[model samples]
Target: MSDTATRPEGRRVDRTSAPQQGSWTTARIVKLVAILAAVVVLLVLPLYVEEFWLRTGFAVFAAIIGALGLNLLVGTTGQLSLAHAFFLAVGAVTYTYVSGTSGGTANAYGGLEWPPLVGMVLGVLVSGLAGIIFSPIAARLRGIYLGIASLGLVFIGQHVLNTWTSVTGGFNGRLVPAFSLFGFSFGGTDSPELVIAGVPFGQTERLWYLGLALCVVACWFANNLVRSRPGRALQTLRDSEVAASVMGVDVRSYKARAFLVSSMYAGMAGVLYALSIGSVAPDSFGLALSVQFLAMIVLGGLGSVTGAILGATFVSSAPLVLQQYAGSLPFIVDPGQPGIVASQAAAFLYGGAIVLVVMFEPGGLAGLARRLRPTTRAPGAAIAADGADSSQHSTPAPADPSTGGDNR
Candidate 1:
């Protein structure tokens, strides 16, 4: 069968939702300006804020990283993995176990003491291992089956953490080592770096730079992958495996490679999360986190890297962002276990947010941006009904009677 079948109307199509091609050079410039503006805000934030804000900002950055990782798997590679928390946990627990005291903070020993960099490296590798080990599932399953199979990873990871006290520190969990960069033992826990001239920045501030740098790298990698021959193979696999095979694409190998690469990104994110939190609890990395990642891709819009970051930024901050309301509510300071009224209301609101996005903006933040700033279309030579410009080609057509055709 063909990659796609037409309905009553004839039109080329792919089952997946990817962006249609057209250079939005003008809009792209605006988008770049907006992105840089956001980065500038981040750079200047540490000077104006205390440690609390710095930590919160760092969390947002970490969440964005996680979301971006998940996006690589689901959004671009056409994989549906809801087990992202497994990688995050793998990173966190790996850092905790391999570091200093070698036990959970709640344990008598306190925790491990590997340098922060070492722990980060471990996290990345462990997370990637988790992904690599799960590669077989991606090779075999598709759509919902694949999603469910990957979802098992979260439960499996949780069970391992909760049961393996020797390594993961069981339920109580271990604290991450105080991050030491280049022999600077955190300088001062909160604000590691002091001002030399007119600049003031904290550890969290420094972390924002790291996080931004990593995210940029991830974006670039994903962009390159999608624009390369391998990316073309990936698209072919996504569009239709059988047809792709006919085109000499190794369908299984390509998908497996995609999964492996996607997992590497996830592993890196996990390491970043471990570094940011300095602790790893079995409860922190759970199915809920996986769901959150899934929701992020949906909210960001699949196949769009920039949109993934946007989704991750918002979703990761959702809890803290909702706390103002939690504090205002009667006897509901804790959102995780709020009063009956607040709990129900919060659940409804969360669901409502997802519903709103699916109903109105299927492409998520990217779609909204596109609407606000439509692409600049050139004159006369419009993209044909299928989004292809026909001006490049010439085809013979019979002349009409009014135009003195040969028949006439």
Candidate 2:
């Protein structure tokens, strides 16, 4: 019945009195349940939601991936970059060029007609390669200088996308080839004639699952990376590069690695973006797109993965949902109409939200959530928490006479 343990040194330590890491507490159980419920809802959402909502969900998933990637670089590593759109373009352009059919009249385009899977993989790799190539520049620069340097990539990419018509299809853009795994085509309507709970699985529905799977994988990897050694090193570097260097952290190497990983994530998101729109245009990967991603991480909370997801969902979906319900919503009008357009309205809303977050809660939504969470510790646990808090702030105790100041 006792939670105390006797050590070989005749010392009694309270085990349960102090909260154990990873132990299943009431809050942990509730959190686990909530996560499982959310997953179930997402999995079955396609069965109930219409095509438009499914399409929007897929777009949100892609945004989440992109936001997470940016957070790793800017939020965790403290490396400012405005070239996310360029990386996304690289992935989209690479995928389209590699898998597309070679034919056109006025605007000639070319392709190798490779498998979609291969194209997707190559897209991610090429994006990462591009990131690594630019990592040296990223490594040397910091703050807005790095951002400005990265911004040049977007312009260069735009010019290449326009001038290199054979690969990019020029300003007109090229149609993105549908993603497929083996014989199963994600874009096809009746490839296998699948049905789920009486809901016919169309292209939208199929792509929804693919996006969901990729989003989950991306989030999972990011979460793990943030808790790993390299992640800690990056965070350390972010806090103080001099300190990190003193701690034996390879500053430049880690910076390069972060760029590599983050760009690859942007690449994956790019492929999804292309698939979502069914096309890749130079205009789509512009300065505005990069700013939007920056907004996502800032609004979500820089170093928090969950914040990135929350931020991405709100930022990506607000405009679409507003446009979808423009007729019913007040002061929201269609394009070329009288009042504010849905896109402008959505931007205003999030811009105000960002300003408020910056003033009141610099940690963004994640910090707000943490502050709002209920503290439901048991009495012993409360004592332990108090002790931990006191220990953090209290001055060091005098050295013991017998131990010679070697407490350990």
lDDT of 1: 0.71
For model 1, residues 221-251, the per-residue Cα lDDT tens digits are 8778878899888877777878989999987
Error of 1 at 39 (Å): 2.6
Residue 394 of candidate 1: its Cα lDDT?
31
Q: Whole-model lDDT, candidate 2?
A: 0.91
Per-model TM against the reference:
0.79, 0.91
Report lDDT (Cα) of residue 184, candidate 1: 60
Candidate 2: where is the Cα deviation over 4 Å? 1-12, 103-107, 378-381, 385-408
lDDT of 1 at 41: 84
- lDDT of all the models against the reference? 0.71, 0.91
